[model samples]
Target chain A: MKKRYLAGAAIAAAAALALAGCAGTAGGGSSSSTKTLTLAEAQKATSADDFGGMDGLVAAANAEGHLNVITLPPSWANYGQIIQGFEKKYPKIKINSANPDGSSADEVAAAKAQKGQSTAPDVFDIGTAVMNQNLDLFAPYKVQSWNDIPADYKDADGLWYYDYTGLMSVGYDTKKFPNGVKKIDDLLGSDFKNSVAIKGDPTQANEAASAVYMAALQSGGSADDIQPGIDFFQKLKQSGNFLSTLPTQATVASGETPVVIQWSFNNVAWGPAAGSAGNPNWKTVVLPGAGLGSYYNQTINADAPNPAAARLWEEYIYTPAVQNLYLAAGAYPAQLAAMEKAKTVDAATLSKVGAAPKDFVQLTADQATKAASLLSAKWAAAVG
Target chain B: MTALASNHGAGATPRRRGARPPRRPGTGWIGLIPFSVYAILFLGIPAVLAIASGFFTSAGAFTISNFSAFGDPVILKDLVGSLGLSAASAILGAVIGALVCYAMLGMNPDGWLRTIVDSASSVLAQFGGVMLAFAFIATVGNQGLIIVIAKQLFGDSALSSPIYTVPGLTLVYLYFEIPLMVLTFMPALEALKPAWGEAVATLGGSRWTYWRQVGFPILAPAFFGCMILLFANAFSSFATAAALISQGGIWPLDIQRALTSETVVGHENEAGVIALGMIVVMVVLMSAYGVLQRRAARWGS
Candidate 1:
């Protein structure tokens, strides 16, 4: 039901762009006349074909000499290695990654605030709901591998596309709970008293919000409804089982939060980090039920200071090599199915992380918007 | 007297009608230009923009609707929480700081005790935000030193404290607030002349009478003024509270929510609205502080 709304909205947006005739080109206000013309052309180009070829795009991006990316932490989904690779590949273009710990909302805000400046973000790696609301801020540009990405995961007009995804999972201290819970209901027992924590504030953090949605699905609610999740948390709080502190590697190691609900990738990353922090008994497991998956989308800023560099970045990350980096980091890349079919994916990493969940549930853009509004209205009153 | 008379005579010499007086030596205020520009650029412009944003909608259209956030029950509750917390910390800090200042009166001016305490007060007053919060957390948090010690000494049913609660937050705020109070209030204490006490004694007044008639009366305005400054200090603090607590239970956290809420769309202006509230309170208290400082300065020189 929610998928239909997303498809309809994407179609409508594409049609509106078509009716406008020309591609939207928000100007880069930081350079000289010649550079401005180059940036303008880069902003208007929808694909490498428009610039003649990938070689032409690379030259144009080298001329720009800089790329601004935001909300991309080095440790997230093996972005540290991916960034180093991009820098090694394009030595001329300096990648300025700003506010690496900022949120998806903060990325949009920075793009809007720094639109015309040299410090403006050239690309955004943001969550779906924030991407949906700020669609106008993006310039439609397709990568060479646009065909490989699933149609449902990318905007019809190439304004935004999914980059990487992860499933929701339960991470726990093995010493405290040697026999991990087989079900969500096990957390409600006395043994888990005042020990259960979420990743962060549900109304702000994507991981925490996904935890709620995962609980809602397990409690018999659909993607369009998130009230049951709030109710579940409220029940957890009333039973003195819910710990208000956000669960982090430090908290997990210190036994402050014995159990946490967060993204599977984060939990997987924490296993080694927590071990070094003295708690070698950390364990993560995908719950035995319907899996909830969420993905962060990538988009080019319409007013990118280095438009050519932005386009090059989008092209670079979507390649098979970069996508494999995400896979190795316990995340399922956007082009996983295509890579698997073509045998381009790294098989060893695939076997280690297990096959991607084919039937994992996701919130459509419209469903995400609805769920966000619902959480904003009821989360505090319910859980507080 | 001769210099004044000669200056008057020179000024009285028939000058051109509407001509300006001669510039006085050492009265050149041009040196203040850099500071003025710095204040206007960094402090003035951002403040104006933040306040002006509250009057506009997300679409950039002028509207008064954003101020409606003030009427929100949650906002009001948080405002009350902020007020109570600030008042508690500031009042306690001021009283304790004043006593410490009073105790310093008996010490020799050049002695090690006064020198060490004054220097320590200056440094400790600036120690706040995440570092200060971490200090308290390591000392008294869930797995902190004191708690671990208590558990070891008295077993499981022993001294578990509310180090994560509102009370705990007040205690953390006072860690810096008291030191700041000492730094600000000590100058007024040092301004007291010994001759005033000697005059009171010569007139057959006791030490209590001298303090009641002379010391308390003069320090009253400065005392209350420092307390107000301390209130404003705690009221506008965000980082210390943010580091200690995840949820919004006070005014600054409400601003943080408005600025960073991922679920709620187009409410960033409410941060400005909350900020405007803080500005109004600060402006009122600072005006009173200005007047009180003027009164306090009379005895200093």
Candidate 2:
């Protein structure tokens, strides 16, 4: 009975503690309450990825010097370089960007944690797909060059814009395919069995996945319809050209893999000649016909902590001066006017970039949802 | 009660024979000082903020929209996935840990072998997040060592496709979590002293009977506590999942929506709803588990 009493008394005490917990502190300090307007976004506001020239937005916030850019952990390595550039170019604007390990989830949490002026990420970079989910959180700030962005790339609401684009092009074994394996439909054979590699299942990324979708579109079937992609992979798999890894371009160049399907820049990054020196024969080609093109975009938060700098950032990135950096970095430009005067890509390179990707099909939310569903089903059916 | 009495006599009663020591008034609650501060800073305050933020708007007005986000399919799916994964990991940890402890208690090898096995628990217990995911990938992804070996040895076409599969994730969770369970259970299992089981057996008790009568009574509470720790540990797995979730497209939902989502749009509030749902489910399961454990403890005693 005494033991029972002790146990019961303990239970009561715990309950009281629970009730106390539920009641919580009637008042906590500003630490619980400050609204740090988070900008969990990339730099569309910077006018360009290169931060070309937007002195108006960067010049000391017009003497107020109030822009704290948190390029915190996981912000890509390039972002660090860009942030340094942003700071140097606009030192008067108090642009503070912390490092963050760039992941979609981290980007989202940074936004969520900063619910208001105190804790909000004023703006941040995110992928084209997730930009819309964050649409409500973002306030609209259209740039002067918004009209110049391809009609296909910019959202109707001006929530996000494609900063630059890449495509799922092939980097072939130039030694093996001396005849120049040129077209999209060329790799459909038994000869290249168990020979190709993908970074992930095509469906994992828009660039690679969009290639499959483009294949379907080229063969017959729009974005909402993706049977051709499924069939294409099915044929590739049957031929044994389906590899998950290491029959990659690196593998191919090393004679492990003969053909690799990868991004345009990736092919450039893997250039045997580009690496240090003395490495041989790393070359790439955009497919002859309209290739599978996808864009990695820059989005500015609507409720950016440094709204003026954000707008200035938008202006700076789209200019011809800064866009050359992207060209050097290996991506196509959004500005046609800039492209017209671009001394960046020479005649030989211009022909390879494939005539400025004639058909630009951006995915609408409903369209994307349906496309994801359809493509996903096709991917599973073919791969499984 | 009799054993405790003997223990009291064996130990210093501290009250009789002038053995009593005066309380240092300041140190009476000294042990709880760190706990008090830690609780407020990490747990108490964050929880209050999480709850309060759920009800209040940007302008500080109360609204049902926060709650409404809970009904969303994507949020619901994430909540279900989180709970399912956590529960599965916990169960796997428990079962695997229990078996490991059983092996340790009465197995083939002894001495250094046992020590090696014992140390393994601690080694694996320390791994989490990206390191853990990468380790699993190295072991199991399409480009993993095992897959490479399987292909080389068994003609390259094996089960080399778990890079982003659900089973692949569970396999990773099991790797670290089972080791953690063994670490947690080692002491509790060790406390089930061999002498007690022998004594119970001498009283004509069967193996099951001995376990039911004496062995279980001591370990029950500790087992439940360990399981609870495992549950909570696996509950908020954001980094590891994010690193490995290739095209599965499921991501960990957290805090609030100062961030934007790409896959599912126009649903920032859904994160709060998911968080709240997780809290509810966790609370319910923990409460049920607690009550069941209490009943088990009562019966064991």
Total clashing pairs for each candidate: 0, 66
DockQ (C-alpha based) per candidate is: 0.20, 0.10
The segments of candidate 1 whose C-alpha lies over 4 angstroms from its true place after superposition are A1-37, A189-194, A238-241, A250-258, A273-279, A382-384, B1-27, B157-163, B195-214, B295-301
On TM-score, the candidate that comes out on top is 1
Please state the CAPRI-style docking class of candidate 2.
incorrect
* Best model number under lDDT: 1
Per-residue accuracy of model 1 over A179-271 as CA lDDT, tens digit each:
797888788887776678886677777778899999998888879888888888888878878776666667777876678888777776677
Query: Which residue pairs collide, candidate 1?
Result: none
Q: Count backbone clashes in candidate 1.
A: 0
DockQ versus reference, model 2: 0.10
